[model samples]
Target: MNDVSYSLKVFKQIGLLKPVAPHRLLGAGLQLAKWGPGLPSGVNAAAKRFPKQTAIIDDAGEITWSELAGQVNQLTQALKERGVEPGDSIAVLSRNHRYMIVAIVAVMQAGGRVLMLNTMASRSQLGELARREDASLVIVDQEFLEVAQDVDRSLVVLGWADDDAPDDLPSVASLMAGQPTSAHAKPSRHGQIIIFTSGTTGLPKGARREEPKDLKPLIAFFGAIPYRGNSTVVIAAPLFHSWGLINFAFGLSTAPTYVLRRKFSPQQVLQDVERYRAEVLVVVPLMMQRMIDLDPAVVEKADVSSLRITASSGSALAGDLANRYMDLFTDSVYNFYGATETGWVTIASPTDLREAPGTAGRPPFRTTVKILDPDGREVPQGETGVIHVGNDMPFGGYTDGNTKSFAEGLMHSGDVGYFDEDGRLFVSGRDDDMIVSGGENVFPRELEDALIDHPDITDVVVTGVPDQTFGQVLAAYVVVRDGASLSEDDVKQYAKTHVARFAVPGRLMFLDELPRNPTGKVMKRELPDFE
Candidate 1:
């Protein structure tokens, strides 16, 4: 679509085309002018427009927009008063809660760079990353106080504390208590947000990104998914990941009521959706699988008919899993394909999922995708090659100074994929994941997809293992459905009929479950050795 038409569509979807009171518009414009359209500005505007409206629902309970804005402003002042300066890096180690949101926004408003730390990181890893990032302060929840203290005991600040929590470290509530709720002075420079990549393969790398100067990223996202303004959204994904972070920024503009939990529970997700009548549910693919895998009685008790859009990302969504989820719930699944470095490359809508299962839908506005061979030439249609993407909100490279491979103006996504005749993109697997066995090349995704199609198979992972004859042969680790039985011979027969002879696993193992990281990607390194 052209720029003019695309802008119109985005404006309509975000409710910008609707009539608004002149005072609210003026107030919002003033806040944007002062804060330069970051989270602080967004919160201030929402407070002006809908002070009584619910802003967030967490473990503590619901908080109104006005209350949230007040807390953010107070925290900003407190941080500034406590010696936080412009461009100072502040590490945040906490789960998804109101205080985590408040601490991040307050640091940004205070002109301190926000570094989001993974909650699953070990104490040593957290300390090493904090020292490497040169963080001036560390804000953490009570649960993670020891980790934060390991990073720097002198610079620790509590983000969330229980009623009986220790009074040693200054908490967000204590700092904001009796403090002025009025807006603080605007800083000379805006703060950058640093997000670490999922360290499934190696050590996590920090990807730095600043707030966009224009609305192109948001426009491109809304143009693809049907997210409306003033709706309720439940974010089940971890906020430290790029997928959840993007949704948080989207909420800033569209003003969605956010529902958050410290830990992910499928039953709790259903209950929250039904309680809030949330129109949007954000999660990783594993969370969706778990929700659908719940007991029939438990699933039937919740009324989730109100969910209109179930946004999924952070990993590949299997075709069979998508089909099962849509069959159980509304046909509202939207799978996103992208990485920390490339932003969003493609978005698969409900119709796209129905027609071309496992296919990443077409690129939205202002984003370009290309399939390029090793020689940096465009590959033919239906030819597998490295996926490259260009977008307005690309990351500013990794903090370690290494950059992704680039061709022309696009950055490599490190994944191999192809475009079908209908123009839909189907990701085959990681470019580095392909293995040659018995003089034939094979990708694990092809085998995994086939095995997951079986009625008794719940989950599966295929990897290349060492072999004396073939150099390397395929090994399959599978999880069977409860009350079902499948032997190695049964799986071998099924694979023999469904897949190529070379692609069949040389060895098979059955387990209760496949080990996965927090973002739902299979931990290939964690797979057990087959004797």
Candidate 2:
């Protein structure tokens, strides 16, 4: 058989080979018929298809598709009056809320690009982006409005005030009421979207992409999980991150009634999933770990039976966590592996986890992966090399001119990993993060995974700092499980038993928590230096 034959066979095995009924296809058409260049078309299409259906639910209340379209029109007209034009930037700083969604759609309708500011960013960083991006307007949540004070005075600032009664700052409700609802023309170019990196090591870089192009990548994703027009989705990930933004984009096309929360906790997440009967739960790996940490009695009380897909992405899902999630959720856990730069490279299903433990699974349809050494030679299976990928989901490069290295036709993932004999991908760590202690290369994940195997250790991070004798020895930072006691010697002894002598840490430190960015990535640069 040919490559296409093998891919189609796998798709059939994953249940994508099923036939679709005529009305369901019609329903999909109704939701996507008007989806032209801008994202507003998707919302308009949804409203036209199911005007009475619930579009979004938040702390404030729910809005129907028709009501959402009206508000989007109102904001769009108001933005037109304010002179928003094609290719202009509309910077946003807000938590997850109804008006934030309104602003995003409205700006695009008025032919402006969106710069989703990180609500977790400091005042200085927010100010810098607004000025640097040359934003024509800055939309702020009242809570984040203070951070916009130092931004360029020429930029127009609009505030989305929450119900606490702020007399100052114009509210989105007032702006929408000021304009008339009417159909708008398409922009000369499709409005682009910009998402920033987590900036764990340095300043966050912006990644911009053109309007939606291919459905193959999206279809490939849907093949791995059940995402459809009628499904309900609960987005626990932050809106500024790629995982959250992409899921939200999928919602726009599918017209799913989505549930969003301002803050995330294990109990809150479980409660929302139960209350809404959400069929899909999209989250980062840390959120799942917290959910797993919840009391068994509390977890038993929640009915997660409605969820068909619990997709984990944006970070590595450790093997132990995968087993724990599957043992509890019963094969619903699907782990996706990729970076913001490369899109999705691989996806691991419950069966894949059961067979190979920590594998990142195989490449999806139309996606290719190659493991190469420093000289760009193809490394044999089971030997670690830099992971590179090329897929239909094209990366349009970064806002900053600096680019990650590329070889052949594939973009470098900067990740170190190897492929098993069964063709499953195993990501070790970032190539830059690899440690060379006493001339023996070490990937911290190897030691960290071993350390976390201890019952008392809830989490562990290993970093390499400069050393005189061994030239950059390993230092361990640990988070002890609650009500658990641990000593440095105990940790070292446990490590010695689980790993090699050189992989053992030279020193150990305990912390209440590891410092992480918004995407739940550990900030090793922020860790204390023993040197």
Candidate 3:
């Protein structure tokens, strides 16, 4: 098989499927026989091959491949009936649930580009994002109904409503019920999934990617990470973020038994892993920490031994967290470093983590990693600089024309890090997250890494809080372990021992938990003003 054809085959493996309809399965067979690069076509292949396999197990319900394909078909037709033409933008705002997955797949199946909206998006951000994009239709969940109240009712679709109440907004369930569960017209080409950045600095820009031209890099990633091909998988990360969405997309290609929980609860994740016998567990750093926070007895009893891979991304996976999780869960943690604009830059396996506790391992196949200084010159090994990624896969540039500058032939990653002597990449901090403390440039990660080792601390986010003396002084927001107690003086003294005095946070505040985006990145702007 050629690259594209092989890629189509990989797409067929997208999670597991089961029988729901014989005729529809036959149709799926026909669709696969005339396979294209579209995701629906992949789903069709899986529906035919794994007709009796379980596809999705979510809070909404369990579904066989037959049921999933039928739902996608129904929604595809419903969307077309609603005047959603191929290539039109369809936005989705919901948590991690079956309907959210359905809306995403159906939109693309209908040849519409799916724009995933962050569930935590504020009303103004939603309005602005919807208005700025070419989205004429938005599929929103009931929890965010109030946020989408102003959307044209004709273009609005309720994705997941708890009560299934009759309302002006058209319902996804109603559409699926009214439409037939079978194949629809072939989608226009599977357009890029437009994921928006967290936009901590400004408006979130869409990082679009065309259909991957080459499958080698992806294949290498699969080979490198212990994903346990074609096994039961549990994804706790929100699909809105790049890390989660990539896994979700890849899982669809592999057709595994996909278990999703709409909201994340530490204990519940362990339960799902045990119940589903999930071999591949995907999480963000925060979720991993939360899972570790569960009672030791509860964790020990939870049978997560089926897990072959516990991949994490979207934020720095602290060395302490990695070691603790590995100690508890048998060294299955894999940490990745990258951004929304650029795909995976590096992936650190358990061995890499064990060797260099926080190293973001070397690049996989067909990927180039470079750390360049302000002058665009490659920085010396082990010197902090902006990260740039060069992969054969085309980055479907931002929709708003705000693209990052390319160094040589690579896209700038906006992360400040350097490669280790052994060629492993390590991210120190974000390019813009640096602060000046007493005339010295300080990266929050310096202090964060220093404090993450403290047993009393659960999680920490260090940000630049303004100070008259230093222009920008360091501030830290910390979450303590259950029943742990520590004073400001205690933390300050501990900070003094680990990092330079200038890097020590001048202000420290304790909280039950830090404010984090769905992807687990701490929202620095949301940090409390303790001064």
Candidate 4:
């Protein structure tokens, strides 16, 4: 068998499908070595397979594998000349564009670490994160370069790969010229990428990738299946996120062509799909909603016939929205569920999505999941409890000193869910967000869903507040529809009939807009603490 097939066979034999049977399963004794050098590892292979095929497309331009390889060579030389050595952290802050791909390859090719800075971050926040990561170099576009002036790192100005730059900052294009194409280094799987979670949690902790063993499954599973060679993928989200990292790695593992946009615009998405003839698209629920909100003719006018699959992750896909998407697009819509701590643990296929709207689908093909009680004991199949996923199949653990996130052998997903008779997983809410009022346990999602059903409410969030008598009381923060006035009584009356009496929100506050993190997750902590 070939090397890849042999590696896959080894993975399967190690019980990639099931947990290690405590009584009989002994750990595999073989230690496998990854062959090949740094950025060239996958790029070299891709170039050989599809030298003339377009590998990346953006508003700026399109690049084939051969051209991409040459760009990587030139940029690597430029970065090396600027004193960026192997293992140095290269901070990248830019919207999704062609240069983003070029800088990433240049960093990895030079054996440097990539620290993706959130483009949506405030100037102060970006500076703080860059300082916290202690990045040695930063590459940014002309628009964001002003924000990086006080970042305390060397800067490389991009968006002008072909021009001569002033003072210290060098143009990205000038550096790529005249550089030798063969200089390369091998990247250790143990290398780290610090990806901040896209959730509403403030002061987000950077998730580290450490285990060499855990890295392969991410490559094998996501690489081969979701991201196959010669496929076209449309990425509308920011590339500095876990989703973006996964997209990059998938391209590296397999040689799929990718198209990126500076910012997500529903109309632009359709235009890119039609223009690039994209075969697959990965998006979050919010972006999909925006795309649906566009004129019906937008979908009809756009030629998305090349689209084969659309994977939605990062948030729940409402039943109504899912059906509407299927009706509008020819491609299948799948749901993916996982956290930064655990890479894509479960996936709901289009069939599963249609059969069960809110279900996050079955555990991934090579991962195992269990619903456990508060005490860590496995709950009955139908019981709602925290979901724990085991990482026996070359899975990486968190970087925190507390390795105890896993109990016995499972990684606690911090989510409340249960399995149905058909073994489909249904996530109800987050355990941390469950509001306990008086003696009743109230889940905010249930209340939020009920609130959104009201015509006046355009967006709503449910949170717990300290109450003198009830210990914790339920409160709802809402953003009303334009020109519509909604009173507290209206909220209460709507919730009372639609939701349980005890679950109805006691206090209602109206705001021009709901506070959300860059990824659109509601910031519950920012909500007023009421009694």
Candidate 5:
């Protein structure tokens, strides 16, 4: 056998193929090595194990494992030909598509950093991010090409039947030609990926992921859960987000058939699950509620039989909403109490979902979580405190002088919450977002949850508004259900019954809709002033 083939065989025989205990490894003993970021190696392994199996399926087309590897190699060569080299940051501003995945892998293979820009982000915002990172190249689709037209960097326009291509833009496929696939790709650790915070509080800050020790815990946590390996996963969230990238990495390493949906629509999600026979789905709570809000006929029509696991992150999952989805799929929904800086610090599993619907599950293997007071002392169980996690947690401070954000070693989640007797973490609202009225501490999430209980309330954001007498009073910006009209008095009355009186919004503004960022997170900073 050739040298590469012989090495791979030796690696597999030693039990590197599967994540198992050292003693459990099979053939050759190579001292159980961890697989770091090596796209070529990953592609090689996937090709060796499942050459005929589908690697990625998107609107553009389906690619088998073999094809996927070849394309990545070709793309890597193409990128190198264009002067893109190791350690260069390449910003990708495009929607979810097969090419996006191929591009990401290829960038990694070429030892280039992948800075994923939200396609939903405004052109100016995209340009600012690219400029801030000093990105070497920008890959954009037709829809967003206009946004990057002014970006002072080389561009690879992903054609999407637009009116006309720019003078210098080249067809994406044509870029790859006679690339050397045999060249050894740099390790995953050699490349870094920066995920910027979704700035609801202020301007976004970049969080650079360096060191394999910095990301393995996160990537490993996803691999350990959801019924072990050899499971199919569905990507409903945008690839740019932490949740999306985690699932994507897990899918790549586990060799799971990853099914991608270009954009999330309730109907589209149902159709994709049925079409791909997906065993797993990564969905946010809002998306779940949207599906639940649909007619029962729609739920009955979508065949979700292949689903084995439903994972929820990026936001809290309401008990009723969690129960509703669990009933629909007969699969428990898992939630992780995590942030962009730290990944899966604590996660609630299927059983946890059924029993403790609101609690984000227990800490994953080899992860330590501490609920601490402001002074950093560990708080007793059931006492609300900030969630502090460590796995060499990656909030090495924001690039924009936000070092105060990370206290000691833990990335101060800024969220307040408590652990139950079972050690499950329940997240409260952000420390800043908490509402204080008449000296009573009130979490807006609790108020928002109670408000959602009302049939007419479609969406609501509770904030502490300026109050002359009370310093700051509870206020709410509510989006009423379509065709239903309600006054602040009605909402106040409804909330009084469900939540504490002080927690009720003393001031309320009825809005057509709440301002949301690209990921559906309510932009509380944009809320107008209300008495």
Candidate 6:
């Protein structure tokens, strides 16, 4: 589609094309003009346009757009008063809640770079990352106070705290109290947002993303997802991850009522969806699986008919899982494939899931995806090669001054995939994950996808282990469903029918559960070796 038509379509999808009062439009424009296009600008615009609209509904209570904007302004002023300067790096560690949202926006308004720390990180990891990122200030939830305290920083603030918060430590609510609700002065520079890699194999590295120069990136995203403005969205994914963070930004534009929870509970999520009549549900595949695995009676009784979209990302959405979720939820599932370093590469819609299960679907508007051989040449269709992608918002490299492999103006996604005759992209596995066993190339994802479909298996992870004869052989770590007995021979027999002869796992290890990071990506490096 042409640029004009594409932009119009995206605007309409997000409800920006709807009629609005001239005065409110003018006010929103003025606010954006004053603060520029960061979170501060978005929040202020939303407040101006829909002051009475509900902005956030968390465990504490609901807050209107006007109230949220006021709190953000007050907290921004307080952060500046506490010596936060432009270009300063501030690390924030907290779960999904009003306090986390306010702290992030406040930091951005203060012109301090925001580093979103993983809530599941170890204390040592947190401290090391905070120091490495040169964070001048650390804001943490009450639960992570000790972890935040261990980090070396000039200032430590409580993002969320109880009434009995320490007298010495300042909380977001405390800072906002007795402060002016007016907008703060615009910072000299726009703060950058840094999201870390999942770090399944090693220590996480920070990926920096700057404010977009144009609406192209936004258009690319909105065009792919069906999100309407003025709707309620339940963000079940962790805010620290890129998927959740991007959806939050999307919410700022659409002015949707956000429903957040400190921790993810499958039952609570379903209850919230019914309570709020939420139109959108954002989650990772793991969370979706948990929700789908809930009691059949509970799933049937839940009133999720109001939901229009159930978006999944941050990890692979298994084909079987997607089919099962759709069968139960009536085809609202949308799977997004991308990495911290590469933005979104592909999005699988309901039709894509139904037509060709396991395919990553296709690229969205203004996105370029190609399968490249080792020589940096585009491979033939249906030929497996590394995936390379180019989008309007290219990653700004890593905070540590490193970058992903780039070729022909595209960044390497580090994944191997191919395009089918119908143009759907099917990711085989990580490039480094491909193993040569008995002189035949094997991708563990293909085997894992096959193994996960077993009736007795709840989860599975396949990896390569050294073998004296084959150089490296496949090892399957299987997690059987509760009360279900599964043996290695059973797994081998199942795989023999589902996969190629050589692809059958040579060794098997049964586990209660597979080790995974907070985002639900399997930690292959953490799998136990064969005895």
Name the better of 3 and 6 by TM-score: 6
**Per-prediction backbone clash count:** 0, 0, 18, 5, 4, 0
**lDDT (C-alpha) at residue 194 in model 3:** 90
What TM-score should be assigned to candidate 5? 0.88
Q: Per-residue error at 226 for model 2, in Å? A: 2.5
Quick one: best lDDT, which candidate?
6
Residues 204-322, model 5: lDDT tens digits = 77876553443345333553354435556777877887777777764554666777767678888888889888888877777877877777898898889888777777776654567
Q: What is the lDDT of residue 340 in candidate 4?
A: 69
lDDT score, candidate 6, position 351: 92
**Candidate 5 or 6, higher lDDT?**
6
Count clashing pairs, candidate 4: 5
lDDT of each: 0.88, 0.78, 0.79, 0.68, 0.70, 0.88
lDDT assessment of candidate 3: 0.79
Q: Give me the runs in candidate 5 sitting further than 4 Å from their true place.
A: 1-35, 38-40, 153-156, 159-167, 177-189, 211-224, 392-397, 400-408
Query: Which portions of model 6 show Cα errors greater than 4 Å?
Result: 152-154
Question: Per-residue lDDT of 1-531 in model 4, one digit per residue for the tens?
Answer: 564775565444323333434332221111112323233445655565456878778777788977887787788787888887777877777777767777876787676767766665667766776777767877777677667767754455664333334456665766777887764555443234566665365655567654334445554355223544467788765677776556555455445688887768889889888887887787877777678667787778988888777867776664356656777886477777877677766788777878876778887545789998889898898988998886434334433434327775888787888999999998878889887788888777778767765766767777777778878777888889777898898789878898788788877788887776545567665676553
lDDT by residue (tens digit), candidate 2, 319-423: 478888767765677888987778888888878888887788889877889999898888999999999998877787788766668887888998999999899
- TM values, all candidates: 0.97, 0.92, 0.91, 0.85, 0.88, 0.98
Alpha carbon lDDT of residue 260, candidate 3?
A: 88
Candidate 1 structure quality by residue, lDDT tens digits, 1-531: 679888988888887665678898788778878877568888888888778889999999999999999999999888888899989999988889999999999999888889888887778878888989999998888898766657657788888898877767788889888889988888877877899988876677999876877778878888888898889999999998888988987677787799999999999999999999999999999999899889989998889999999999999886478878999988999999998888998999999999988888889888889999999899999998999999888678888898888998899999999999988999989998899998998888888888988889989998888899998888999999999999999999999998999989998999999878778988776788998
**CA RMSD of all predictions:** 1.5, 3.2, 3.8, 7.0, 5.6, 1.3
Model 2, runs deviating above 4 Å:
1-38, 152-160
Alpha-carbon shift of residue 177 in model 2 (angstroms):
2.1
Ranking by lDDT: 6, 1, 3, 2, 5, 4
